[model samples]
Target: MNKTDRLLAIVLELQRKGVLRAEDMAAKFETSTRTIYRDIQALSEAGVPIVGAPGLGYSLMEGYFLPPVSFTAGEAVALMIGTDFVEHKFDSDYRTKAQSAREKIEAILPESVSQETNRVRTTIRLLVTGETYNSGREKEGLEALRRAILDKRKVRFHYSKNIPGADGNRHSVRDVAPYGLVFAQGSWILVAYCDLRQELRHFRLSRMSDLTLLEDSFTFPTDFNLQDHKPADDRRVLVRVQVHPDIADKVKGAGSFFMTQMEDHEEGLMATFHVRQPEELLHWVLGWGADVVVLEPESLRNRVREEAAKMLKGY
Candidate 1:
């Protein structure tokens, strides 16, 4: 192997096994002992902290690991380009952490790797979100919710829910213990237990105000599974929907959106889906416009007709 290849291999060997005898490396690389000694000298001159003793062979200094040296120019461009893209779309508060991680990655990389990284950083570009990003408020709530979820601990936060037909008197405010945070439709939602309802519930983090983390903690029962915590089967009503033939490929796939077996129909393709609430799916069906037909479960058909009539009245 050439000098650069030999040096990189030696560093890798030291890292893998924690130590290597010069004689052993020389034999592995098919180089003479004298040449290996010269390579070691060159490596030390280049700031590599290689530790060794006459009888013990050679080992890298503790904590001073070397990175691979054979990275190509094209590869570096790819990394910097990708990192730049990620740097923007990532949450604002997490951006700094991402940058720090980038620095560590650049540090461990060999010159070719580092150079390629820089080339991409300098040559490639990314579109920033334009809008000011402040993850401060969102970050704290998420952090608290994350910790609670991972450790199976609980956190308390104040929240509000709007009451129907009550105008200003409709606002209800209270505290809850957060159990899990879920990402849906580009928003963050906290699933928690309502001390009032005595059941698990989901709340939009963005909608919550005066959020504060509580010191008190609660344990999730070994029986409590997050996957099974959605509104219970009682609230999940089965409604059949007919998907138009043209839209079948688009709508009839696996998801909470539609139930299985999207069969072809005279009017359209028909299937069933479980919905806990009406408003969300109502909009979804409308988004498909006239292409989808809401079938069976008279409640759903009535709901669609009622909503449609309301839309016409509004217009």
Candidate 2:
């Protein structure tokens, strides 16, 4: 392992054990006693509190404490579920990080609850096989962009919109100051300033190519609201529909279409969504077998009727 990896591992290991011997640490790291002492010295200089005697070995200074952190049941479940879900993200390296995180959690958590959690999670597998995940460049760009946002710094990147041309080819490249990265429908979106549009635009991360971070910085608009920029459905097309009483329970929770696939909803559930287009919603409504029907906004019903008639002729 490199210096950073070794350093982080040492801290985690120390955190695992209240105390450790310098000789044992050197043996564990396959390094000499002097090197281990030097490493300990570097860690102390770098903010880790190490205190002890030579014969008694060393210990992270007693009484030193990290901020107390608490997790609610809801939060814990959410984390496990989120991590399980993220396992499918394309060619993602976060799986290793996820494993390390789970280990850390299991290490600190009450044995009984943690064991039960692991029992179920072990049987669950999320595979993103045959999927082209976010390219490494996109991931790096996103990481950099996120760090910049946290630091309130600005970044410049070479961005290009995958806009189709009259001949179905990609349009010219564009420049962007990435603002945020969002995942929708298992696809990532990079929300940024499109210099070509001279305004805000969202680009599909999977389609973005040639990303570069510029040293330029920006201040978010004082009145800026990230939530408002992309509602639960940004390209949402709302349409009223009549669903059967049998499926009414499904409507009780209008799971976010952009965030989730409405896993709890029953079949034939009629719901309104701001999708890319009206036809897409119509197709969904029709797929609910016969229990679903269009109730309001005559325009949508008429379009469905037209499509149905056309389909009937074919049948």
Candidate 3:
């Protein structure tokens, strides 16, 4: 491995093992102990917070955090692409934070790696067209919600439902114990336990206003695992679709989180997805236009036809 790469690997080894001997590092990297000593000296000179004891080898100083480690060209490009997506697609407040982080990554990268990363970044593009998220109007609410989630505090907010019920009151006050924040379907959703509803609910950050972090604190449930928790509307239907060969990869990449199975065919790619709602599948299929065909679940096909007819009528 290159010396620069090896130096970075040594830092990673020290981090993982808390301490590493020069002999062990040499054996792992297939280099001489003399070379390892030189590398250690170089790293210490470069302000890496490395400390050595007489017999204990080398380790990072306690409480010293090495800024993110070096990245390969491909990894750097991927990070830039992902941050760019978040900068465009996420809330404005988060977009600024993501941009700041990307700048830091760029600033710390070695010049050679930075140049190749820039080359790859220029060659790759992620285009987000159409109105995916609300503008930055909900910045305060989102920030408050995040703070509440982090502090394990209850929050009170007035929410204006996109569709009001028969009572015709557009807004209602709710008290919830914020558990997690989820970014999905182009919106920030607060996954919280609603004191009023007496159950967990998802509240769109955009629809929330007049948010206040309550002084009252709550204990998060020990058994509540965010990864395993599903939204209340978690009923799924298996929907199949045929994707045109030209755009199959794009479709799969975008929907990889929800797609269950895919098979390559002569004409195109056949894909099955466990979709929570037909509207979600409808919107996705419509985005592909003629490049995608909904093959099963008559309900989804009919919904697509109905929505397409409405679009045609508008034109």
Candidate 4:
């Protein structure tokens, strides 16, 4: 960051955090302590009310705040897009807040900048895919989970996994201490400490039902940071399928998340997928019928045969 931008950011950080040590500021801005000292001196000379002590850190004077800042047209457009995303992706409560935020941003922008931002935004669109994106039930579940995460409370719900358990049952009841909410691949996933399993697990909001907030509360782990948490990757199964050339473009357009690679083949198009289990691609393969053929993993082929036989019986 330039000196001017860094100076403004340091002041904003002080205002937000109340106080910060020189070492802490140096680390945050990724600069040397000497640079931070110089910046603080510069701010002091410019009439910024920064008070520092020998041991304690530097702090902004009580009741001091920076005046309204200006935004370039590009910056304005970026903010507008962010608000648009929040309005569409979040629940009713946050949707209202995003609308208010967008209004405030537009009110502050110059008329020319506002017009330019609106024109640019019109050329870009955020499309919603899948049934779970804006479903009322999904929205309600997300909102409930959000409240649970913020309140440090436990929640109870019945979850339906794609694969059945050893008992041939796909549904199970769970009581978990909510840790965080993640939005990935057009789905809302709740990362929590599962009471039954005694470990952290990810539950898709769309597969959850009868979600209820419990009065029982739990303490969030101080060491656990949602931003740094990396879930184990379990998609080990490799699936290869051959698609007829006639529908190759359509299959590519589908944009299946599991698909890792696709290439033209002598027979047709060779498409490869990575999944947690072979069953995850069952219905997807069946959707193409004769146009698609599973090349390996004999288990998936046998299962497909059985399912096709069952369909013949129904006819």
Candidate 5:
């Protein structure tokens, strides 16, 4: 980067991290400590509120803040693409907010950069499937749920419960202390302490109705860590599958979420995934049809064989 860009980046880094060591900055910028020092000196000369101590490294002076910085063409394009993804994948309220944010960003950018960003926005497309869009009531409920979670308040909602051999869905009003929200598999799930069940439960946001934010406040448990929490069936089982070469790239791209490891093989790509349930893994493998073959876990293989036979019978 040029000296100007480096100085701006240094300000941004300090603003983000509060303090940073000269050695670390040097390594991050791929430059010598002397160069970093020179850049720091240049920024100081420009009246930037930078302070340094012998052991504490460098920091901006207290209460120092920089004005909004301009984005390069590349940065603008990236932001535009992100907004596009949000618009396509998120709920209507979120999509509307994203569109407003994009407009505000565009208004701040230089004409040339703005035009390029608009071009990129028009060209890029992010498509997703298996998503159920929220109705107006559900959108309002989601907003209320987020507020309840943030405020450490309790919430009440009528949840639809699916029971085996039931005539229809059973509806029950549940009082829950909101904890966290999770977006997974194209659905929003609320993780909360259900007063009705007397335990933590995952409630599908879509299956909830008559949502109401309670005035009763709750104390958030200091010991409760969302990252440490796991379901009863959290034991991971390794599932191996072979994939066709044509779809290998797609399979590998999804490895972060599933298919934890993959390698090339003579037949195709050998992929390994860690899943809590064999049926969950089976469903994913079956989605690829003949392009994928389960290689391990005799139970999963047998299940796939039975499903395939049923499919063939339908044909």
Candidate 6:
């Protein structure tokens, strides 16, 4: 970067990180420490308030704020698209904020830049299924969970599992300490500390019913960081299926989370899936009817056969 841009970037960095050492700034800007010193001197000469201590690094003076910076046409487009995504995916509160942010961004851009950004953004679109209503149940659940997480409070809900238990029960009540919310695979997932299980658990908001925020509060763990949290992977069973050539593209495009690999074959496409259990794929496999044939895991094939028989009997 040129000296002018690098000097402006240094000011923004100080505003963002509060304090940064000369060595760190030099490394970040890919320049020498001597160059950083000269840049700092140049900024001071330009009347930018930079306070440097012997032991502590350089910091912007308290109450000093950088004026607004101009955005490139590409940057403006990216930010506008982000706002569009937020408005479509988030709840009512965030949707309004996103719209306001978009307006502010557009207002600051030059007319030429704004036109270019608009032209580029028209080619891109965000299509979110099952989020038609702003006040849908899932969005409502997200709003409630967001509040509970911020307040460090407990939440109660009835969750419906995908599979029924031995007693044919598929629903259960849970009391949990809300930690964070994650959006994955077109669904909102809640990460919380389950009071009953005495451990962290993940719950899909779509499967959650009768969610209630409790008055009880809990201390947020200091060590728990949502950015670094990785959910355990438990998919162990491997099931392979052969797809007829006609529907091979459709099968490949299904984007099943359990699907691992797809190999071209003379007969058709061999699609491999890794799941927690064979039953987890039973319905999905049967959905393809005659087009898909289970190649392994006799249990899934048998289950599919039984289900097909049941369908035939109904017919």
Q: What is the TM-score of each candidate against the true structure?
A: 0.53, 0.48, 0.57, 0.87, 0.67, 0.93
Cα lDDT computed for each candidate against the true fold:
0.68, 0.63, 0.83, 0.90, 0.83, 0.90
Q: Higher-lDDT candidate among 2 and 3?
A: 3
Clashes of each: 2, 7, 0, 0, 0, 0
Residue 26 error, candidate 4, Å: 5.8
- Writing each residue's lDDT as its tens digit, candidate 3 over 73-185 gives 99988888889987875656788989998999899999999999988888888866545234454555766777777888899989887331124447889999998877776
Candidate 3 clash figure, as a count: 0
| Superposed Cα deviation of residue 268, candidate 2 (Å) | 11
- Ten-residue stretch with the least lDDT total in model 6: 160-169
Error of 3 at 135 (Å): 4.3
RMSD of each: 9.5, 13.3, 6.9, 2.9, 5.3, 2.1
Off by over 4 Å in 1: 1-93, 110-140, 143-171, 215-235, 249-261, 265-267, 277-280
Which pairs clash (backbone N, Cα, C closer than 3 Å) in model 3?
none
Best by the TM-score measure:
6
**Models sorted by TM-score, best on top:** 6, 4, 5, 3, 1, 2
What's the distance in Å from true for residue 111, model 1? 6.0
The sequence of per-residue lDDT tens digits that candidate 1 reaches over residues 269-295 is 777666555443666777787887777
Candidate 4: list runs displaced more than 4 Å: 17-35, 53-58, 131-134, 164-169, 263-267, 312-315
Q: How accurate is candidate 6 locally (lDDT)?
A: 0.90
lDDT accuracy of residue 245 in candidate 1: 79
Task: In model 5, state the lDDT of residue 88.
Answer: 65
Q: Write the per-residue lDDT of candidate 6 for residues 47-151, one digit (tens) a residue.
A: 999999998899999999999999998999999989998898888999999999999999999999999999998998888788544237788888889999988
